[model samples]
Target: MALRTGPGSPGPGAAARLVVVGTACVLLAACSPPAPPQVPAPAPSTESAGPTTVEPTADPWADVSDFVPGLVTWDSALPEQSVEGDPVEISLGEGEDPVGSFRRTNVGLSFEASDLADERWEPGTSSLTPLIAALNQPSLRFGGNAVDRRVWWTSSDESAPDWAEFTIGPDDLDRIARFAEATDASVTLVLPLGHFDPERAADMAAHAERALGDRLVAVAFGNEPNGFHHQSQLDLALRDEGWDAEAWVGEAEDYGQAVHDRVPELAVDGPGAYDAPWWRAFGEAEIENKVALSQHWYPLWSCPDRSGETEERAEPEVENLTSQWLHERAETVFGQGKDTADNYDLPLWIEETGPTSCPGTNDSSRTHAQTLWTADFVMIGAAVGAQRMNHHSSLAACRGGAPMSMVCGMGAVPNESPRVIAQSNYLALLMLSQVGTGELVEISSSDPEVRAYAVAGEGYTDIVLVDTGEPGTDRAMDLSVDADRLHGISTLTAESLEATNEGRLRLLSEADAVPDSLPRGSVTLLRFSDE
Candidate 1:
């Protein structure tokens, strides 16, 4: 990996992330460098509780050493790797396009419809609701595989559809509406396509509309119609054999039209396909009131049968958490979807996505690797122009059968878990949450292993650097800048990159620590005033 030593002299190749570093810092008296970033000892679970414990660490970088005026050097442990980086010599000026904002519509969390029923969502009673609010009220999306396999329009005591896991009645939607309101977010529900009854789908939308009112942003049909044929439980309930994209889109539109007939102008989102062709098919189709293009992706699914596996990416056991292949695949997959969405001038949405869709892969998905991955995923989502990059989560345990969400539910029972567990990976959100909402600014990096991005918010531009390589346990790259890198930075803090199994972060400042090369297998975010 090389550095952009000078202009026109770029590093890495086309396959690498297109990122940039802060060229100059606007040093104001208020923008004084806070402190050198350090990894604080892991604190026990203080948020809520449900068997959430901090994975202990060796505290490798605990000792302070002398450093050059501009160079940072040492062993890294991931963030809490010690908080700090070198600010590169660059700036966002005229003619540079600011990418999308991390807003409610753009950044959010997802859940299964039945999962909502598993808890008591009466006002301030639900533990998850408060945490959802902490995410600054990002959009709350309901619908997953459950939409197609587990949902019914009304609460039913009868034989219930063989596929029904739970009934989602008007009352349920009513409670959900209240919950969403309490969380300060909007709602998007994916209706069932398994039943194949346009009227039933329409009826479901009407009930949701009656309950959610203006809070209901849009409605989507089916979870992932392209893969319906693969799941037996959903296969029998869906269209008969020979249900290709052509057939799928036709029926998908039928359901859309049916719902729109009753609730005129109710925005609709669709396909929810996991493949490329399906996205293109939906993009080409002329559906009424189509708002955003949607898809589901699992970048780190450890299923032995999952495609793109090689000796490097073995299953069950965690693969290279910071591999180039992992980052490249994300760039390619999301890039393709973005192209389809762009062709139609629609906003692409990753309706469901995470480290792994399969459960019990805690060895892989639940680690700090996910924290690094989540940071990279956010930058990728911004660069690719995705409108909603909602990380799918479950109230189920993170230690559940497999790894899926950053926010994991604990306890043997469903929502009965004494406390909901927020995994270490969630630190990515907490870090970025600093810049409530902002437009993405591109980062130009000469290093392949290290990719960076800047989010230019109202008064600040946050520079994020992520290391996609294995740990350099012996060496720490002290990135140095010559002049004026903190020009516009008002109040600043820094975190060095280091990977650790421990889930802890202390927002303390050391000295005049401002920003560059971070601890390997870690990520860094530098906040600057855009003055």
Candidate 2:
């Protein structure tokens, strides 16, 4: 392994400044220094949660100490290693055209109506807002599959919807509006559509508009309206009304128009379909009120008995969470949404999505593997032209064998067992936010086992790399950075991809270090100076 050094140029204040990494410090000696060195511990490399290093003690060509040691020298050049297996070669083009831009609000979280109606939504003691802020203040979506059946109550005279159990009222919307305000995020509320009522949706829209102001991005009329046509009771109701793709589109338009009449500026988004066919049909329809095309996605169906069980069974195994599976899914899922959106001249937003379509998968969703999968998911979603990808998190607790709850239900006390904390997906969102928003560029990877995505903006370029090889294997990739100096480096890894911790999602963060050998099932993000 070779550790390449720069042409020995002195950095500003090179003698006085010290960077702390772990417990070690490296002296920045450019030439024969004139002043005494104030050696500080090495600074942390970017916001990576992986192994860190300290400066090497011997000559630049001296024996390479442990690279993954608690501390290794990193001053002028990054640590490099020899090729282990077939190295994944990544090449970034020096093109002026950007493939896409990363949206800070691109990643979002979804909640159920009952979550907002909880008593714990007080001003000071609220756990929801803190958790939202922790997750990078992602756009909040109120309503999941439960929204289709949940009823909103404004007055006593109005009868509840047939599926109404927990009545969500104006106060609940107030709580949602308040939560959105605190988190500095836009709110996308899903209206009941299985039992469609334009009046009810319109009133709620008017209230939300007043409370949320511009924070209310859009109003989705239903949750998976296309799939609703298959439900026994829902099918009978829709059949009586002659409900189909075209009809659903018209209904969405009508409901959206009614909401517009109440609040003229609030935009509408929907059919929230599970497949591409419905998206195409919705796009092809004459309805034009939608500001953004919305859809749902799940890489695999892990919970077999969940609602609308599909025959295509792909379990959420650690092995299945690979570069190829993610690559294909990104190409296919985002491709369909982007194509449909382009056809209709609208932005594509994944209103609801997750690692596993069902609630949770024991093997992967609960483990560190979700972090890698989520990084790929977000980056791929951005690369494919989708503006937002809202990861669906049930407001309720994990029931049965499912464990996909981002927060362990509303009213969860802090410091309590299973307290409301950020989940694996939340960590992924935070990492991307720390990486910063920029123009996403094209990054070609030579090896199929290694995937790379780059973002160029804010006078820096960030390259996110992931090694999707199986256990007991490591991937070494040569990355070319067109820059005068390498500034930031970090990696995200664990004991293994399948590892998980109780009370909290067990994860670790090391100081600054450049990764030369990407261990199996790990993700790393590297930042380089443009100059």
Candidate 3:
């Protein structure tokens, strides 16, 4: 007698379950109503449309490329942007202040001379020789927690000094001396502050003076003292040893003074800090000009939680953060009181920076894309008037530790040699080194993603264009360049993007160069000789 339309249909006592099910159904129906059926509106007749007029909107970016020619400017401190063949002349004679031509900042390797053994020192010599030849690095820093008195000396006995047990013993010193002599690279020594007595500090400077002789350009008292708060430690040590931290800025001034007194020619700078407080303190202290300002920057480490991520995402973020910080810092430090010409006199150097110290950091460090990005960073820093940029881990083989050797593996496994491996950063630096020494000129393109910079050489012009956008999107940039005059152009670019051979950037001919399409994630360096 049960009325049922189907199995489990509501029967005698099923009304209770049915009500719950029915309520759920109603709620679901209310939650997700069916989309209203689309109804096409009636089309307007040709007469009613009135010739189908289109509205015009003003484009603010229109004719932006046209302004490229007039944007050229001149500067005496650095290279000038000039028309390739224009009669606007500047002095760039041979041996005539090479600083103007030395636009490419050389990032030299940092490590202690003591960690190297005699056999290791010989190969290190050969390894660094070619690198120095290739990069023309101006200065090298020796001391990165590796050259501490504890690591270098045989015993802790202060009275009976075994100078033979020190890392800067006769053999290692000889090798460094010979290496510097053979290659025209200058040396920058960092004396250990944590473990050494003042006498050892003085002795270390004396030994460096004798070993390196005139090759030594500068000495940094301690490494990252602001970060370590070693200033307080040095202050305590000085007070305990009956020296005044208030009279001086602790060991930085003391050791620097000692080194300066010993070698009057050698430059000294310090409290190498990651924060602004140390820089402000050092700047306000009326320190000698010979004591240069020093700071270390690792844009990735500044955001440690995300340091090992891929550059595709991380680099842009880091760039933005760094640019913002640098701009604000520059404005705070140098942006006041001038007719836009002579605003601030302080010269800052990015003493250390790199992609990341995390071993898990993306392979972008070894890619050509990284090279382009690094080159862009260099150019941007230079454009903003940074004195120098020393990329961190330039020599460090492993992650999160001092460099094991001048030549070792970059990642966890030691497959590729850091010195010999042709990383994108290495190639980028190489390409930059080849261009003539002149000032940076302005170039414009329709694409916002395409960054263009031009530098006038002695007799030629170098134009560097970078496309920093997502891959697979072809950037159609209408590049309008105004040089002294147009002559001929030589283009250099990478032909491939596949992982295996991506780092290969070649000088392409006019026929092969001007492609209807450029590969995604690539850089083009074009050189134009004056007619």
lDDT per prediction? Answer: 0.58, 0.57, 0.41
RMSD of each: 10.3, 10.4, 25.2
Residue range 116-135, candidate 3, lDDT tens digits: 43333343422445554344
Q: How far is candidate 3 from the true structure (C-alpha RMSD, Å)?
A: 25.2
lDDT of 1 by residue, 57-162 (tens): 2121121111001113222322322323453333333223534555434457888877767655655564565556555445678888777777776634446777
Higher-scoring candidate on lDDT, 1 or 3: 1
Q: Write the candidate numbers in order of decreasing TM-score.
A: 1, 2, 3
Worst 10 residues of 3 by lDDT: 22-31
The better-scoring model by TM-score among 1 and 3 is: 1
How close is every model to the real structure, measured as TM-score? 0.75, 0.75, 0.60
Ordered by lDDT, highest first, the candidates read 1, 2, 3
Candidate 2 residue 256 C-alpha distance from true site, Å: 2.2
